[model samples]
Target chain A: MKIGAALCVLLLSVIAVHAAEIATADRKSGFEFMGRDTQAMQTDDTSNPGMLNVLDGGALWERPEGADKKACASCHGDASQRMKGVAARYPAFDATAGQVVDLGQRINLCRRDHQKAPELAYESRDLLALSAFVARQSRGQPIAIADDARSANALMQGRKLFNERMGQLNLSCAICHDDNWGQKLGGTSIPQGHPNGYPLYRLEWQAMGSLQRRLRNCMIGMRAEPFSYGSSEFIALELFLMQRAQGMAMESPAVRP
Target chain B: MPFKVEGDAIQRSLTGQPGDPTEGRRIVISRQTGLCLLCHSGPFPDERFQGTLAPSLAGAGTRWTLGQLRLRLVDGRRLNPDTIMPSYYVLDGVVRVAPSFAAKTILNAAQIEDVVAFLSTLRD
Candidate 1:
């Protein structure tokens, strides 16, 4: 009986440690925190405003452009087949660029390298549209960020940045999202900072936006200088977020209040 | 002139003038200025929203002396290094401050005194 009690305490301690590391069972998507109306908007394609960007992106995929006069479909055939589950493995290390790149950057890289076209400006309508369209293909797929040696350093930096105190507020991402998630902060419930939803529509912005834009908004709210768009720091952070959110289902083009 | 800290408290008033509790309450509840309600709930009945991130401001006077409250407003980090509360009257050691807020503290000395005064009134 004494040994059984000791073993029970030991098992409880182990469970506590695992929970501290973010147990898979405890993971909840930002979608779970939304109201019924917003959830409905994300569910139906016709009612979702983000579908408009996906539609525009579908059109852009067939239209030819650049010096090569090639559309994305010319090389990849159909996005439904070629792009499915593609977003799940993104924020990966790019060998040619010799660094990590997110889905948006990957699209620009393809335009520059394969189609011989100029890169689209960050946060532009066409870029967001194309990204939203591609991400829509992987709506139900789980995130699977690769954890090879090539991306190990970037991943470490991302983890560090997430915990580091910044801005005049001196708040880290972990302080609010990790410690105080589900708690009310001035009438809104704080959410676990997940990256599964990107190129999604925000009610606050009233338009489609990328993960980078959202990160910048948080940094400004913290009163910290935001890292420039397309900076390696942002990519590294994205890489870290994707890895942290590993195995969670993708909800790109998601709706958030 | 720099304010002096003795132990965990500031003995002297920051602006060397008695703070009006009425003005202090205004600053504590204002979103554009103090932002206290963003992370703290206080005794403001008219305010529809209050934060749940920190201790309630109700009965703060019963909890600590006025000098201690003053130190907390000035720089709570001096007491607790891991606190999420901003050092309202501190400027040095902060990084990447936006251009408009570069050299400024979150609250002025007068405002800090006002908040302290308002907080002191919550004894109950």
Candidate 2:
């Protein structure tokens, strides 16, 4: 038991080292890179396009579903009460699955077990809406991705993927997000690419999107084929991103260009 | 020779007189060709929002010999295995390369020379 405890300490220290290795210069949020007008759009709930998705999620939260005919509200009551701070803890280690599960996966799990509803399609309207709504409950809450023993390995893996160069462009996420965040890439100001403002509405996409969808967009932009939605790579990457943005305020329904 | 491949590196001429600086500068800013601006800020004062990821190319010509610049453009992995910079002139042994881009160097020989020429001109 002593040796086991020592090994656990050793492993956690390793993860701590890796987690702390994020460049100091990469501390800015993606929101910091937005133009003035774009920044203004995200600040106002009415002007922010992402609020549309969040409002849709509010409607979905109470709607009935499945063989049990129960909505998410049936057992939980008001999400603002029960679901607060929930989004901030996700992409956490799921012991039963023996791997990291992102917020999207966790939501689907609840949908299956509680709502008895069919899983929403990846990036589907209902999924985006629901995620946006739940994440909105945690607005202004500091992000705190899981860092326990169960999550250490996935966090390291995600960190490696973020730094490793891939795609026809031969750029890693770090090149733009970490090294040159305040600079410009093409016409847009390059951001630190944190996951804080996800379930965001993008002007380029002209729609609300989850963090996974944004990851897929970067993958496509790098000219690499995107992994399947909810794939381990995406989950691990999401875990790393959340941990990377560990202390930033949540901005789930943010608007972006 | 436009360039000669060495063990894990490439060597070329300083005074080869092959590439055009005017053409090279144009390609450096072009998104499809040199893509120098994507990761590097060059000597363009009027061009705003230059990248800060890689080192600025403002004094590149004075910073290194033509041979060093050529080696980097040809295959930067030789200098740093983990460098995010692409091997612009290497055409094989890469994984997950796009189908349209497979077996093709990112920049042609002339374009490489052009980029080198442009980079060398950043003496100030």
List candidate 2 stretches off by more than 4 Å. Answer: A1-26, A95-98, A186-188, B1-17, B20-22, B43-49, B55-68, B80-83, B91-95, B117-124
lDDT of 2 at B49: 53
Best by TM-score: 1
Clashing pairs in 2: none
Kept native contacts, fraction for each prediction: 0.59, 0.31
* Shift of residue B53 alpha carbon in model 2, Å: 3.2
What is the lDDT of every predicted structure here? 0.88, 0.79
Compared with the true structure, model 1 gives a TM-score of 0.93
DockQ by candidate, in order: 0.34, 0.29
Best by lDDT: 1
lDDT of 1 at A13: 54
- Give, for candidate 2 chain A, the lowest lDDT window spanning 10 residues: A13-22
Q: What tens digits encode model 2's per-residue C-alpha lDDT throughout A142-247?
A: 8987559988888888988898767776767876676556666654677778888778899999888888888888977776666778888888888888898898
Give the runs in model 1 whose Cα sits over 4 Å from its true position: A1-21
Error of 1 at B90 (Å): 1.2
Docking class of 1: acceptable
Candidate 2 lDDT over B26-117, as tens digits, reads 99988778777877887688777566657888899898777788898887766555566788877654555556776677887888888888
Task: Give the candidate number with the greatest DockQ.
Answer: 1
